[model samples]
Every structure is written in structure tokens, then in C-alpha cells.
Target: MGRWEPNARMRLVRAAIDLCAEQGYEATTVAQVVERAGLTKATFFRHFPDKREVLFAGQEEHAALLTAGIGAAPEGVAPLDAVAAGLDALAASFSPEQHEFSARLTAAVAASPELQERDALKTVGLAAAMTAALADRGVPDPTSRLAAELGVLAVKQGFAAWADGDRDDAGALAGEMRTALESLRRAAATLG
Candidate 1:
């Protein structure tokens, strides 16, 4: 009988996540990941440079959707609204199980300072990706970049509230961000 093989990238990611979840991010090693995945060193390195990157494989996919969503946003949709809509679409794309896994991964990252930096970088990259997409769609102000960044931050926070294992429904967490933004706008108007 042939040996059963796992999907290489998926195996590596799952291995990293399992290690991080069980042993914390700093303690998890590449060998541990490969071992968990039931794969060789070569296979693990071929898929990811390190365990941290494995936790973020979905980053590129999410960025792509952000770009595409902003690019395709209907005419007359404000930039921030466009960004929020894009995020809503992204949230809609995940199934409950995927959301649960995503929540675990986010928690693992948040608990580690180094991983928090990576998450920040990922958010910056996502915002830049969205800004470029908005520019292509005719949004020409610097506010486009700021708005995109803010939108992503709000979305991230909202998603965290939703992904809370106590009761997961990140899409519903949209209200929290909406209320926050509204408050900010009101404060700005009062200052003006």
C-alpha cells in the first residue's frame, strides 16, 4: 500500500497552527511543524519559510479579494463604504468552521508580541492593496488610503468580536465598528 499524503501547504499550515495552539508561538519549531504534518523538512521549507508565515497563507487571498472588491465597487459608493462592503464580502466568504479556525489563529497571533507586528504589517499591506484598487476605480484623494486603513482596522476588530469562541458570528460584529465610526464622525463634526 502507498503512504497517504496530505496536501503540502495545508499540512504545513495546519501543523503550524496546531503547534502554536498547543505550545505557544515562540516555542513552536519548524521541525515540530514538519513532524506534525507528517512531512519531511524539505516539504515544510518548500511551503513556508517559517511557522509564522504559515499562519498567514490566507493573507494573500484576502488581499486579492480586497483589491478586487474595491475595483468592482459600484459608482457612487464612497471609498470607506466600498472598503466596508469589501470586508463584508470577505466575511461572507468564510464558513463557520473556517471562521473558528481563523479565530484560533488570530488569538494565537494576538497573544504574541512578534506575531502582533506581523498582523499589523499584514493590515498595512491590505490597506495599500485596497488604496491601489480604489485609485484604479477613480478615488483620487489621500483620504482613500486613510479610509482603507481605517476600514480594515474596524473590520478586523469587528471580526474579532464575531469570532469570539463564546459565540461566533463575526459578520454580526459589524455593528460595533459602525457605531464606533459614527461616534468618531460626530466628534469630528463637533470639533469643526
Candidate 2:
């Protein structure tokens, strides 16, 4: 293997996703993934701790984006609005190239109980990140938690819609997430 390979992380991720989709997540191994990517074990370990983490490589970066987006929001804006800003930040990180990968990751998780549990943990982690950011902004306790939940839901719903919708749609992931967040906001308003 070459000492320096560009896009090694992405190549490993794509190879893992393709292998998982082809075989099964449980049946797939780190060795197989590395082999498929034509990268050495050292390179794979440098990028991911294991095969499962390949699917969740963006978790930390995503949480940081959420926190940063909320922190950057104008002071005294509503909590949900702050969350919307966070979602915008998170969505902006995605590219058209990732659309297919998102779809495949969703499917791979759906097919495996282990991946589903990991995905759930990811959701909780994301919510915690958003909640902490909101708290730092002086959002009240229950309100911060509530807003975080809504933000997470919006991300999931919006991601699903974007991944499953027409690839040619003019609207991007940000638009879908904004729509989902607005829908949640409207629903919450109806409760009062």
C-alpha cells in the first residue's frame, strides 16, 4: 500500500458501505473492508476504530457543527430557531455525492439490530450536543431538552425525505430540514 493516499477515509467508508449492502453488516469484517478499499490495516485503523464506526464517522464533526451553529445564532432568538440554525450548519456539510451513501447507510442500519442501536445512540449523542449548546445560550432546562429533541427529529425526518426524494429536486437537504423543523414548530404551536 502507498504511504499517502488521498481520500482514504472516504474510500474506506464507501467500501464498507458497499460491503455491508452486499453481504450483511454482521457478516462483514474489518479485514474485508480494508481489502475492498485496497488500503492496509494500519490505514483502516487510522480512519476508523472498527467496521461499525465507518458508518458513524461523522458523529463528532456533526455534533460540533450543531454546537457551533447554535452558538453562532443571534442572541435571544427562540430555541427552535437556534436549532434550525444548527440544522442549517449540519446540512451544509453534506454534498450531492453523499446522497447515495446516506441512503445506503440508512438501509444498512435498518437491516441490522446492532446498527439500529448504534444509530439510536448517535441520536442521543446529537441531542445531548444540541441541549448543551442551548443551555450555554441560557435556554431554560426543559426548553433546551425539548428544542434538542425537535432538532433531532427534524434531522431524521428531513434526511429521510431528502434521501428518498427525487435526486433532481431543486431543494437541498437544508430546505428539507427547514421544512421539517417548521412542520414540527407548527405542530407544537397547535398544542397550546
Could you report the Cα RMSD, in angstroms, for every candidate shown? 3.2, 1.8
Model 1 lDDT per residue over 1-192, tens place: 111475777767777877898889999998888788878888777777777788887788888877776666788887777776666656655555556576678868978998999988998988888888888878886877767767677667666666664544545555555544454445545865
Residue-wise C-alpha lDDT for candidate 2, range 65-137, written one tens digit per residue: 9999999999989999999999999998887767877788889999999999999999999999999999999
Clashing pairs in 2: none
Candidate 1 Cα outliers beyond 4 Å, as residue runs:
1-6, 165-191
State in Å the error of residue 107, model 2. 0.4
Clashes of 1: 1
In each prediction, how many residue pairs overlap at the backbone (N, C-alpha, C within less than 3 A)?
1, 0
Candidates' TM-scores? 0.81, 0.94
Which model scores highest in TM-score?
Answer: 2
**In model 2, which regions exceed 4 Å deviation?**
1-3, 168-171
